[model samples]
Target: MSLTRVLWFAGVIITLAMGIRHSFGLFLEPLSAGGGRETIAFAFAILNLLWGAAQPFAGAWADRAGARRVLVAGALAYAAGLWTLAVPGMPLLGSVMIGIGLAGTTYGVVFGVVGKLAPPHRRSQAMGLTAAAGSLGQFLLLPAGQWGIDHLGASPTLLVFAALTLLIVPLAWPLRVEGIERPSQPVGDAFREAMRHPGFLLLSASYFVCGFQVSFVGVHLPAFLADRGLSSSVGALSLALIGLANIVGTWLFGHMGARHDKSRLLSGIYACRALAIVLFVLLPVTPASAIAFSAAIGFLWLGTVPLTNGIIAGIFGVHYLSMLGGLVFFAHQLGSFFGIWLGGRVYDSTGSYDPVWWASVVLGVMAALLCLPIRERPLQRAEAGA
Candidate 1:
């Protein structure tokens, strides 16, 4: 098969896996009721934590072996975890298992495959397409989950989603594996070299803010709308709109990253986010306005992924792309943990999400500023030689 066909196929499988995983937010209420709010929170935290922690290993395994083995095992684990979530009173274990499964299947393995297939010039666009597929999944699935909850109920909905994950196994079969040649530098040394790079640090830190904003809003936006006396459907629609908009956003950013200074583009995206959040808070909360805000913000959502991954690939080469990208994602997930957990804690304490909203705006601005001084050109010869 052609490279485009391979990418499109891989995109479908990765998007489905991630989309179903993210749609779990729709189950928070039911899961919380079954296991208690704290338990549910812990489960999600564990999920993100394990998912992040496992990426480096998964990436390395994929680099040394091939994504096929890791991805198939990951698909089984992901399906099993979703199935577990369907069982009553199994929230904690189910969530942790789901995280482990996600670690192997999602970003690391999928991107590793892309790194292998895509040429350097087209890498950013490939990442963009892949990320857009993930957003598409979010746009499509969250509402499906809501519908299932309202009409069919959460447990059955989850089971159905589990079945959907089985699709990953067959989809992964097309991945072409070229055998690994030994790295000129030791893997540990390469990792250390990446860690010490200024661009990598900036990319990782900026991604943290992206995670913070996206996770908080993704998890709480529906509830926030409900608290304002809007219908639950409004909240779901808002999220769906965001997911839809992200498709355009990611594609645009992917194209731009290929030609422009990626770091500056990242700064601009964050700056736009800060402005959007502030305006959203200031605006009236009408349904029309809510949908408008969701669409606008969604366009900016996940746009960072392509740029961030692109920078890593550009700076470091595809040989260790998955391992380094996984580390950056680890930072993103850590921020996600804080964003989701803190949003919940603050809501419980204050009965309002105003503080969290304000915090998001502030962090967004700070993140933009952080990206301003980032040097995006390839490393100096001396640095590269290291």
Candidate 2:
């Protein structure tokens, strides 16, 4: 019953954060001009960079202090960021604030709490439930964002999201698990240890492919479809299909993680992703092909999160899960930075996404090979008193 409540609250927080975040672009459009669209892009870039940059520190803080304090600050910052959307000359700054907020409110911290609270047997399931919750939010929010924007208008919608984000404050109280450090080692030392681990470095490096693949596909797929002479609706529906299918994908992989070796699973995901992308463009570009491809790709989407977080906890212990996971995620965000920018740059230069598509294939193969040799054994400190 206790775990149930904790998962429920954590789910709500993730759902709210993910759902409202997608809609931010809608409301921000009205605020652009004089390359304001580019301004928004730059702001989003800043947000992603800051979110990655801040995550490890946030994770470390959450590890040392209880999560409740960090969560409250994140909630407030999120609310304040939404409110900033209503202000003049504030969208960019709001992005910065929200970036900081996300470092606390997002997966590393929430899953760190979940990972700690879960018994060894059920840890993967807990992580799955959380990922499923966020996937559900993404599915629902796509249409909901359009409706809310049309009905509420930009300013009111921003205000509404601000109010909604505050709910995370109270919800955070139920999952305030404190950090557990090794009895003999300082928290900084745990991070230092990870910094030295080849497995940790490789794991972090592989996740960059994840961020790159997902962001590139998500951002450029619609445009790619258009270039192939497909209808815009085809592109839009394909994205929606990916979101809807992702819920099942995340849960399925999460379920699989408990019974199988997570490293092999991660490798399989990247390999399958590579195969799917190859088939997607190589096959036909019809609506049917598009939907099928989208669904296949979507099924692989976010399948990495639970398994990756589970592996990190399994290998390192959950004592510094958030901080360590945050560092890994920061690497993922940097990959995201390069993925989106490079995809656009290539398309503009070559008038084709094939080069980027081929790049995804190469990266996928690399990530697949990368995960195979990762040592999945728990860190030595895990067996000692913390």
Candidate 3:
């Protein structure tokens, strides 16, 4: 198959995988009722942590074994995880399994595949397209899950997700290829080299804020809206609008990353996030305004994924793309842990989401500043030789 077809196929599968994984947040209330908030939180936290931690190993395995097999296994695991969710008292185990499934299936694997397929000049755009597709999944699936919950209830909703996950198998077929030989860099040395790079560290750090903001909002926004006496549908719509807006945003940023300075664009994106949060908090809490905020913020959402992945490809090489991206993603998930857990903690203590909202704004501004000093150029000539 042509590279374009390969990318398109990868994009579809990755998006669906990510979308389905993300929709797990919709199960928060139901799972919490079955267990407790702590149980649900712990389950999801375990998922996020495992997802983050497993990335490097998954990436390394993909690098050695080829993305196709890893992706296939991931899809199967994803389905199994969803099936586990259908069983009573299984959220924690289900989440960990789901994390493993997602770690192998989504951006870390797909972006690595794109890095190998796409020419250096086109890598940014390819990453953008992939990220945009994931946003599209979020747009399409979150509401569908909500509708299923309203009409069919939670168990059936998850079964539907499991069925959707089976689509990944066919998608993985195109991705199967013989493994390519890589330069003989020791794994430890490669990781150490990446860790020492200032740009990589900045990229990882800035991504933490993205995780925190997204996780906190994704997990808590519905509850917050309900607290304000809005219908559950409004909350669902708000999340969907954000997902929809991200489609446009991811596409735009992808194009921009190819032509503009990625670090500067990243800085601008974070700055916009800070402003958006301020407006969201300052504005009156209403369904219309909330939806508007969701759309605006969504445009900025996941815009970082492509640029960040592109930066890794640009600085390192496609050979290590998955490993490096996974490391960065690990940082992102760490932030997600704190964001979701802390949002709940703060709300429980204060009975309002105001503090969490303001914290996100502050973190956004800080991340914007952190991104400014990133060196977007390739590594030193001697280092490249090494």
Candidate 4:
């Protein structure tokens, strides 16, 4: 009953967090009225970068202090950030706060609670369910966000979103699980241990690709579709399709992770992503094709989150899962920073997304290869005399 309640509330929190996040792309054109695209993109870049940088600390804090505290604080930060963002000339400050909020509210911290609540056998599925909830949010909110932009306009929509994020504070209460014990290992020791592990490093590097690929798509795909003369609705639909398909993909991968070798599954996912991007880019542009591409790419979207976090838990144990996961996620955010900033810079300079598209394909393939070599087995601490 406790686990079920935690998962339920966690899912709702993720749904709100991810849903609002996925809508940022929809605001680009509308927000463009106030400034150049790069300025907005740079703000998002800062958000991703800061989110990544803060994740380890947030995760560590959650590991020490409990997710409820971290999550409530994050929720407040997120709401405040959105309110700030709605103000003109405050994108940087707003993004910084939002980034910090994301570090606490999203998978890095949430998954730690899930990992602790679910047994080893069910961990992957629990994480998957949470991720799917996030996807569902994306599915539901993308179109809603577009509608808000079309009707209420960007600033008002941001304010509304800010108000909605406050819900996370209330939702976070159910996540407080009492009597769970922590391992004796110092947090610093765990960090050093993971940093020394080759598999952990490789996983972090590959996750960087995931961040780069998805962040670019999330922030830039709407504008890309517009460049192809498609309507904003089509762009909204494409993003929603990705979210819809991800519901299945994340769940399927999460189920598969329990029974299969997670590293291989990750490899296959990245490979599929590369292929999907290639097809999406090479095919002639149409609403149908765009939707098709969205489904294909979206199915592959966040599957990595469950599988990657699952691998971390499997190898290192859940005691430090949040912090370790945060370390890996930080690498992903770094990629997101480049992906978003570079896309805008390239577009502003060359007026094309081709370079970034090709870059994604290449990165995807590399990530696929990188995952092939990870050692997913838990560390033999006793054997190593640690």
TM-score of 3: 0.95
Give lDDT tens digits, candidate 1, residues 85-109.
8898887788777887888888777
Q: By lDDT, highest first, what's the ranking? A: 4, 3, 1, 2
**Candidate 4 TM-score, C-alpha based:** 0.98
Error of 2 at 15 (Å): 1.1
Off by over 4 Å in 3: 34-36, 176-181, 381-386
lDDT of each: 0.82, 0.80, 0.84, 0.93
Tell me, by lDDT, which candidate is best.
4
Clashing pairs in 4: none
Cα lDDT, model 3, residue 52 = 86
List the candidates' TM-scores in order: 0.94, 0.88, 0.95, 0.98
lDDT, model 2, position 212? 83
For all predictions, the C-alpha RMSD in Å is 2.2, 3.2, 1.8, 1.4
Candidate 1 off by > 4 Å: 34-38, 179-182, 379-386
Report clashes for each candidate as comma-separated counts. Answer: 0, 0, 0, 0
Q: On residues 47-159, what C-alpha lDDT tens digit does candidate 4 reach at each position? A: 99999999999999999989999999999999999999999888899999999999989999999999998999999999999999999999998888989988988999999
Q: Quick one: how many clashes does candidate 3 have?
A: 0
Model 3 lDDT per residue over 1-86, tens place: 56789878988997799787667667777666744455676677777778888888888888767888888898888888888988
